[model samples]
Target: MSDAEKTVPESADAAAPESAPERQAPRTLTVRVHRCGPGGANARFDDFRLPVRPEDSVLDVLDRIRVETDPTLVYRHSCHHSSCGTCAMRINGRERLACITRMLALGTDVVTLEPLRALPLLGDLMVDMRPMFAHIGDDWGYVRPVEKASTGVPHGVARYTRLENCIECGACMSACPVSSGTDDMPPPEARRGGHEAPAQAAPGADVADAPQERMFMGPAPLAALNRELARHPEQREALLHIGKGPQGEKHCRRHLACSRACPSGVYPAKDIMDIRMMHGGGKD
Candidate 1:
């Protein structure tokens, strides 16, 4: 008990599970995922054993493996919840929100995760969304605006709240057949050219007819079209003009897969219907 003689308690590690070491060992979960390297070659399934818990989602497993075991195991994820659409990936052959897709719901102990197909894959489980967002802009649609009268009271304010819940997970685009194969399409970039780039119509060049490319409108714009149309009780005809041309409302195939896979339930198919009704009629 003397001040100088008193000793601090031994560290927990010094008196640990020497008698039952196996009980402290972490449990391993089987992870089978598709992988692609720098070039498109060497595509194959890569397996890894990860320490995981029953309540963990597929995203959680991928994150744990990437951080604790292997840094090269690449994937996109943000918000951890469904708020940010960064973590959308395929689980067990279906498009789903990896952050919410529970490990137990993944069926077999051997879980499989993959990137959204048809889009450009940056690495394992990461695809370029530039193409997807570009299609959204090309559709020339905007979120339908509520009138001033509707904003006066609480009842009107909440009218469009449900549609705003979309996280843009891109599961819709992954399910679309057109986005997978069309090569002439331009991926969505925020702007056409850099600030310093010369204007094509300044002098000798006839930039008016600069070969407007025929691009396939992807799901984000189609989803936006749906969101806008859902509230556009009056502007249906005008809004239909947004997606009217070759790459507009004419592209949707009425698959309804977009709505089925939307993690937040934005109905791109129904939106396409509204556009069709405004323009003329549905395709036969």
Candidate 2:
């Protein structure tokens, strides 16, 4: 009613902090899935629009598509929990377990899904783990099992619980520059992950003998690290030598991608550092 009152109201509105506009949440999210024909051939992409649900996981949307839209769709998931290491794939350019990867947290309206790189692609989002597993050899050579009673963590052995632990998810390998173009790559049947290599490469490794340059066995070696630490004292030195040898730590590019992509917090880079520090590496 008064000019002074009107001016005061206008000044208050001008001085107030503009509440940062709340972002409008999407009602539906777009999922662009890399579809593979049987045996993971003829790779292609298909888009699916699904209703966004509260705390929706990437796996949740995929399950909905499989159950309601197309029964032919295939993917792998043993325990929907992160423990199984079954539902890992390239989601939005990062290798992560679908079960635990929240769709909303990605902060993107559209999410892209594809099989992990570096392993033989089986189909859709599935890759072969058998080839990778075969390298371990039959004698895991951990602590030899006793017929009578088995023991837990060995005394005086520093637990990898902090520095290095592996769940065999292969996500680290997927992100590693050293895990590609193996000189003696196992046959497809032996491996079932995507053949597409990651974008990065080790220094001087992008050219000829790309596979040969990779010294360590890549991120999967952490699993073997777990086992070796459990082996008898006599066997420990040999294992440490392998880590410091060619096809081991000497090839690491220090990219840090594998360590970052890991969902299990394995700290593979730290593991490499620990081995190098312990062995005082030298000429092979």
Candidate 3:
């Protein structure tokens, strides 16, 4: 053999560095997205395989699945960041902001995305927030603003400030089991109408406009009421009157799931505990 032909082809490793084992292709993430489309049977999970990078967000994977893979995958999302909370959903059995949940944090090749449980599913991953926020209003809703603007800082300013953090995203509602399934539960809109329902009945009446007055209130609105009650001690008696009955604090099962699912850390479980204290005559 010639000198060039006898060179042994550089031993394959010395010439090309062994090709680096094909670099593994960055891993494709498989997401099982629960979908409930119009006239669909019950709810079903649609599997989507997406190639994901380490820095990709859950929302990114979902979007890719929607656009590139399955156009039928339905979900709600506005801000790609965590500011909107519109993309909040249950990822891997935990409520999270899809925009902020990095793919690497899940530590799994398969990520399951579902709507916040309990609330009515609007479509694929969208759950109705109206009922959840309405749950709060059912328990005395908002302060009546005693005197337009009293106490130098405004009468209901402190109460409003604290409750304003609520994004009304239904994270707390999704976590609450009582309000989601049980009948005879009053939604928050029953207390404060026009925004959610626009035709809810008066606070104490079983008005024909809204039948939700008899249903149990969920955690989100109750949490807001708890914040309001924390501000105005005098409102406790009235709040208790509104918060009583099957639709009130009695519905909560002490699950503490509201606290766990809250993307903003509002702590609906703690709020419900405070409501219980007030109901028990701790303060008002």
Candidate 4:
């Protein structure tokens, strides 16, 4: 072929690859939600079937269902990026933040969602978060001195502070068997050593008549206490008193469920263990 013909300009689009195949239709998901009314009256399970894209999160599905399927289906959510922790729930029997939990990655056709236990359940998936916050207490500081060397403090600033990692999602509380009193955990006397068992209730007396005791203060609060202690050594004595109280780190039972359920990387179990070591509890 002549040089001119041989060198005929290549098509402008010749280098481009073939267009991608058509995207598949979204998959349908069966979301089974645990429902309850005020004071847990008329509790039931409601199933919602909807089409979901692979990237769709559990919160997204719930939003679609609420708008198109049922407006009355109630749940709490804010800041869908998982920072708010408002959408935390039991996803397929594990504590997870719905905002970040993708529907397709669950590897199941059906997704079961339930509210965090041990908190006062309101209608539908909503629960009273007040109790969880109460446990964390009012004095626990949310911000800490920034430690990264790359992010230097601005001039005239004594130090920089950033919000702590714990979002107070209550996932730790839900996952903690001791805090929720689920999983048929043995009594304190049975779990602890060198402690005398209390007198048992009379056989004939009504069980309801007996005074109920408070369980552990839970991983979130204990973790917060630890953080506070780390930030303020002057408060060590006061904070340690709380940590070593009746509802303290000693009752953790070392399940480590809180660490697994935490999406914020707080590692509450490790903090509890640290508190134990600090107090000479010796890692029981």
Highest-scoring model, lDDT: 4
Instruction: Write the residue-wise lDDT of candidate 2 on 101-171 in tens digits.
Output: 88888888889998877677778888887656755545554344433433466687544233223567888
What's the residue-level lDDT of 280 in candidate 4? 31
What local lDDT does model 4 show for residue 88? 90
TM-score ranking of the models: 4, 2, 1, 3
lDDT of each structure?
0.65, 0.68, 0.67, 0.79
Q: Model 3: how far is 201 from its true place, Å?
A: 26
Say which candidate scores most in TM-score: 4
What TM-score would every model get versus the actual structure?
0.67, 0.67, 0.65, 0.81
How high is the lDDT of residue 7 in model 2?
A: 58
Across residues 125-220, which tens digit of lDDT does each residue of candidate 4 receive?
887787667766597788997776576667998777788999988999888876666635445546454533332233333222333344567799
**Candidate achieving higher lDDT, 2 or 3:** 2
Model 3 misplaced stretches (Cα beyond 4 Å) = 1-25, 39-42, 138-163, 180-214, 231-234, 279-284
On a 0 to 100 scale, what is the lDDT of residue 260 in model 3?
A: 82
Q: Rank the candidates by lDDT, best first.
A: 4, 2, 3, 1
